[model samples]
Target: MPGTQLTVTLSGGDVADARAVVRALEGSFGAPDELPGDENATVRTATFSAAAEGASGRPAPAPSGGGQEGGRLSAPVTVTVQGTPEAVARAG
Candidate 1:
């Protein structure tokens, strides 16, 4: 079966803020095809790929905010997550 793809977009904050969220998700989704850029764009996006749920050995565990922190967000952000139903559920 084809793998699932998740695309997350963060707005209303700088790249650092976006990176934080992305990094947090990386714990579950693995690496992203697109990483947030340093440029001062209004939006930042990251795309991650994963095998369909139950199609692989096991899913990655969700990330925790307490241990080994990912990063801090300087401000609030508007996140837009897009993908197939399975992909969205996995990312959620």
Candidate 2:
């Protein structure tokens, strides 16, 4: 079956830091099938497949209830998370 995919686009901050933020999400999702874009780009994107097999050959865990907590980034960043309606709800 096709998986639920999440495309995260990040702008502002350096590409490396933006990539770091996306990689951090792997703890809850999994390794992205499509990694962040060019290192020199001001904006980059990463895509994660929720139902796809990970390195362990198992689907990544479904994200569940969580509340946002105040935090600070090294620099200002604009982030956009896009996915199916169901997937976006699950991510929340």
Candidate number achieving the greatest lDDT relative to the actual structure: 1
* Residue-level lDDT tens digits of model 2 in 1-92: 25577788899887656766665676656667766668689888888786554566444653342312333356888888899775565445
- The number of the candidate with the highest TM-score is 1
After superposition, the stretches of candidate 1 with alpha carbons farther than 4 Å from their true spots are 51-71
Q: The CA-based lDDT of model 1 is what?
A: 0.72
lDDT for model 2 comes to: 0.66
> Which residue pairs collide in model 2, if any?
none
lDDT of each: 0.72, 0.66
Error of 2 at 50 (Å): 3.2
What digit string (tens of lDDT, one per residue) describes model 1 on residues 1-92?
Answer: 25578899889877767877887777667657767986778988888776522356354564455323435567789999998787688667
Model 1 lDDT, residue 78, Cα: 93
* Cα RMSD for candidates in order: 3.9, 6.1
Off by over 4 Å in 2: 51-72
For residue 53, give model 1's deviation from the true position in Å: 10
